[model samples]
Target: MHASATRLPSAAAWTVGDITVRRIDEIALPPQTGPWLLPGATPEVVSQLPWLKPDFADETNVLRLASHSFALTVDGMRVLIDTGIGNAKTRANPAWHDLDTDYLTRLAAIGFTPESVDLVLLTHLHTDHVGWNTRAEGGSWVPTFPNARYLTTRTEWDFWSTTELDEPRTQMFRDSIHPIRDAGLLDVVDVSAEGTTVAPGLTLLPTPGHTPGQVAVRIDSRGATALVTGDCVHHPVQLADDALGSCVDIDPEQATATRRALLASLAGTDTLVLGSHFPAPTAGHVVTDGDAYRFLPYGM
Candidate 1:
């Protein structure tokens, strides 16, 4: 019932066998960051695709859209795929600071607590992706979930920790990653192989290009599998046109390649696609709509 005025709520879940599935919370749609300047964009091409509304005009008038994140519950462990924007932090821009996040509380409402989380899987090192990695401890930033092991790909960890980033992205690592590392809770993982199973059924599938070592998590349990697409395909509209990469994409060509291949493999299978920025209940299946495929949001 928490549907955005400009978007609809869609969720469909069933056990792969014994694993429980749930979409914990969304980051909510952010307000437009630019003035409307496009001229060729048509309403017909925009409004028809719910995910394309942001590209047409501001939807903030009607929708309280936020970013998206997912919780994959397997065994007795609750694995959070990605952490949305953290509550408060310093950045190059004020917009990224002072945001509200009730993530831990939200998880608790669904019977998950910080201690119930055994692993925190970071798809990449973007600020928004790692916001909840730490919390204020006395006068220091400490691991938010002292009991959880935060997992990040070795490639990503090496690059961000070593590379010199602009003020914003640099601040991101300083806040979300450094603190966890200092706390001895950050795990640098090598997921360069086909995939690596962090737990019994949760695997990290490398889907780099959004960043050097970006990855999407695949969870298999009870004969069911779900792909947390991270930022491989930020908006569902990209599935229709793989050439369109986001401004933040580090390698547009590679990202497009990664997106298509991943979506194709899950197109007609039992695999459910979970996109990081897709609308809440951000999961669905791909269906052929003539030459282009369309996303059918799961209905539960």
Candidate 2:
């Protein structure tokens, strides 16, 4: 289907201290050049980074990217970090095959439904980050948050549940991750453990090589902080070309050394980075732009 155009400002909540974070857009892809999705992203290296024009490229430079998700309320909890590219799955990339949009009606118009989500943070298991975690009902494939709790990372569920994928990532692990492990709610955790907590301000860092065991969702609260970069900085010109990766970064030199140590631990720090395929003001802050690094997005 995919017809709703002109809905630019999709959603973008952001609180931080009390912890809110919202960003629900499911598609905002226009300018796409750079050898077609970041192979050094040329246009003369993004026109020598003119602070990435307009809102991340397009004055002919072309780059824009977005496929969103990140609800994240705090104490009472309602997580949901990455679950885009979902709807009618059968993808071999024909721009994410067999699709439709209105991602859960834009996640219940931002109030978040799907049984009020309790937690579904899968920062890995790519294929557009586990396409909605399941939802094709009558024809089968279920668990679209039926009382959440989906988290991942037992080394990213033992490498996509015993690696061997091909036909569109083994039909995206048999329909969005084995129907959330057949509805037992799938919770693998142990993100290289040390009090991994996924609530009370949420946490889990291990920014692995874009896929390996990829995790990133920090959030903190009253003291304020935020991370959520699940694809490890997809576009923001890879925060000033840290060897520009993402041609499906399987290990582009350990995803460019995990994006230069998470942009040197949030360059100047006020944290708040939220970019899993960043597009419209997709939240940002990592600075220090001399040797390289600069994604100041939040509201500018």
Best by TM-score: 1
Tell me the TM-score of each prediction against the true structure.
Answer: 0.85, 0.34
lDDT of 1 by residue, 82-117 (tens): 887777788654555767667677777766677677
Q: Candidate 1 — which residues are off by over 4 angstroms?
A: 1-14, 33-65, 93-95
Candidate 2: residue 140 lDDT (0-100): 89
Q: Give model 2 RMSD, 1 decimal.
A: 17.8
| Candidate 2 lDDT tens digits, 12-65 | 677777666777877775454335668778788888888888788888777778
Instruction: Give residue 151's error in model 2 in angstroms.
Output: 19
Model 1 pairs whose backbones collide: 16-222, 17-222, 27-66, 27-67, 28-65, 28-66, 28-67, 29-65, 29-66
